[model samples]
Target: MADSQWVDWTKTTQSKNYRGSGSFATFMIVGPVCFFLGILFASFPYDFPLLWTSDPVAPSYYDQLETHLRFVHQSPPLIARLLNIIMTVGFLGFFIKLFRPSEANVLFDGASLVLYVIGAGVYIANIVKGMRAVSAGVWHTEDFKGIAHDGPLTGEIVLGREDSLRVLSASNTILALVLVGVLVLQAGQWYAERREAEDNKKADQADKEAAERKASASAGSGGSGKKRQ
Candidate 1:
């Protein structure tokens, strides 16, 4: 059984925009990154991980190439989408847990959701088809530049119709615009919530002060208002 630790999904860890660029960005950016690296690997299998060392911490080799495709790239689109859906859930958790203030958060949540769906659709297709081509030697794992390669690679890779991919690529551009919208909305919500909270706090303080003043006046006046004459 998997680790039984409980996880909460409501507390955001980063900005809504941070989460927006999340899964979609991974599929959008890294999908192509892998293709490029796959090409590099196809062309120079020995030097694959050298050129693409990333920031803060380096990307794992399996991550660079997409480890899941090692076996399941042949499943139907629905099945792959199922896998994509599961992973996207985690991506969303990253968004919800860190993203707060609902202003940007909700908007990004929508964008992230859309990204998860669309990007996953495209990526899963590409990965499955691309892997077949690669395996058949049509797209050399090291065909980074495609300048040199034995004819062992199959034609599906070299001559594959990537027009659908172009359409799929639109998911990134759309998600990016949505992320901006999310940021704007998040700011608005933050400002509104902050103002409301401040107003409530101030009102409570004012009421307390008024009560204290009333008590002080009553005590000072005592019962000898008319000098007891």
Candidate 2:
């Protein structure tokens, strides 16, 4: 009976989508975003003072700022490239799954992809632009103009430095929040899939028990007839 039940369960599971593999693919897509989130969080201490404080930029701050800027310049581009590669792979997998004749939850994958694209868009549109501005040291010439500048210091526009830093910090904050949203969406997908698997398992068990009871009743009826004869 146990063996029969196991065989029935295996067949039932095989008839459905390969959800475990799908979930693994989804994680691969999300993994880099999570890493980016960690980077953003870890930089808060280095970023907050430069962004929020009204105190004059001390000469000593330049060293720390340079270190932070160097990291900002180097890390994100690599991370973004990695993210793009992973997203491409994920999309390929999604298409393959969609074409399969199984009951795959394509909707979840579609929604996740949409959210991830939005997050990527946000990063590219805002964060990447900010990074470029910082790298070129040309923030004052772009964007807002109505705000009065603090005038030049050390033969360069001090306000531009502040503005670029602000842009970088603000963009990072927005990207971090967007990544959080992506994480939440993935979490919900995982939970829904888990619940679905449990439900399927229960249904399979119920069907197996019903089949066993029906067989037992038929056997009993046949024996009773033989005894009467």
Candidate 3:
């Protein structure tokens, strides 16, 4: 009963759009995925068999794992890339809310699901494409061969595939930017909503105070009338 009244009041005052809920949902989903990716990239080289390379500073295994460096799959990618995945779930939540905007979303948080799944999908696809460079054996930019240092012994270690990797990175960057921009817009909406709620609360409180003042004055006049009679 008390819960229902509080809920009813919230429904009347707040916007039915629950898209904002997704922002936080995306945050949770993206967090784990990025953590996993961080571990994957950080550990993959060490776990794989030893590869002998002459480059003093660069670890041979690290150079070899470069075969898997993707624009949206590395440390930098983990940041916004993971976030966008979570945002996808949030967006989905918004879509569902349109059908039943006022309903309680206690069990399933749809917005988070949509944003997270979509964002994760993007990261997966891009990362796989990066791995493809190795399987294809073209030794393209992401291919370990491309980044290998050139010297008297190894002539342009990657053969010749700079343009391709640059293009792949650029394309993936665009995808990330699109998803991140959507999240940023969501944040803006949340800020606006919070402000609106504050204003409404203040207005409601003022109205209640005015009513109380009026009632007090009316009771005082009635008591004076009785005394004079």
Candidate 4:
């Protein structure tokens, strides 16, 4: 069944309206990549500490000279921002692929891509804001106040704390959800096509079998009549 289904799929793909293999492969691959990137972007802020602090037991964190000097402290925001840039480009790629001619649900794809752009835009803004705030020697604490910390804090700040980073995290989640919907809609279209091809093949086989059986029965009847004469 799988092999026959593959044959049917190959035939459908060979149609003039079907795009080339490159677009087809990208259509399948890029969506999930965007989704994973969304998850990474959403989770990264929580994993990194915003407060700059050296002392583990310190109650109040300050923006110490070492925080600026230490590359390790700055790496998290830098890395996150870089990844955000990559994912932003990924969203563009997804958008382009979504708009390409295909048999999938175009309306759903277009809507999903629009939501993706909006969500990614919000996320990018949040990350840029964080990077800018860190570079300026100020950290937006979980309570929403900007604090000047001496070193990076180990405690995790949950997103949505009335801060711009909250917007970033929320947008990432929204984008992920939208991408998932796009996947579902595309899958639905593919499944429908596959079922249709299989049904057509079945109908053709049934017709051929009926014709062959009628011919065989007629041949048997003619032979009996000759023998009886």
Q: 55-166 in candidate 1: lDDT tens per residue?
A: 2324464333433333444557797565556555545553453333233444444454454455445445554455554345433355444433335763333432222222
* Top-scoring candidate (lDDT): 2
TM-score of 3: 0.46
Top candidate on TM-score is 2
TM values, all candidates: 0.35, 0.63, 0.46, 0.50
Model 3 C-alpha RMSD vs. true structure (Å) is 11.6
Model 2 off-target regions past 4 Å? 1-24, 47-67, 74-104, 139-164
What do the candidate models score in CA lDDT, each in turn? 0.44, 0.62, 0.49, 0.51
Sort by TM-score, best first: what order?
2, 4, 3, 1
Candidate 3 residue runs with Cα over 4 Å from true position: 1-99, 102-131, 139-160
lDDT of 3: 0.49
Q: Which of the two, 1 or 3, has more TM-score?
A: 3
Q: Tell me the tens digit of each residue's lDDT in model 3 across 1-229.
A: 6554422224432554442444454354344544444544464343334222343434453444455553324446567565556545545544544333333332233343444456556546654564455456555335355356446576544433434444344434544544454455445555656787799999999999999999999999999999999
Worst 10 residues of 2 by lDDT: 4-13
| Tens digits of per-residue lDDT for model 2, 93-142 | 44544443233334455565666677677778766765655555453366
Question: lDDT (0-100) at residue 165 of candidate 2?
Answer: 64
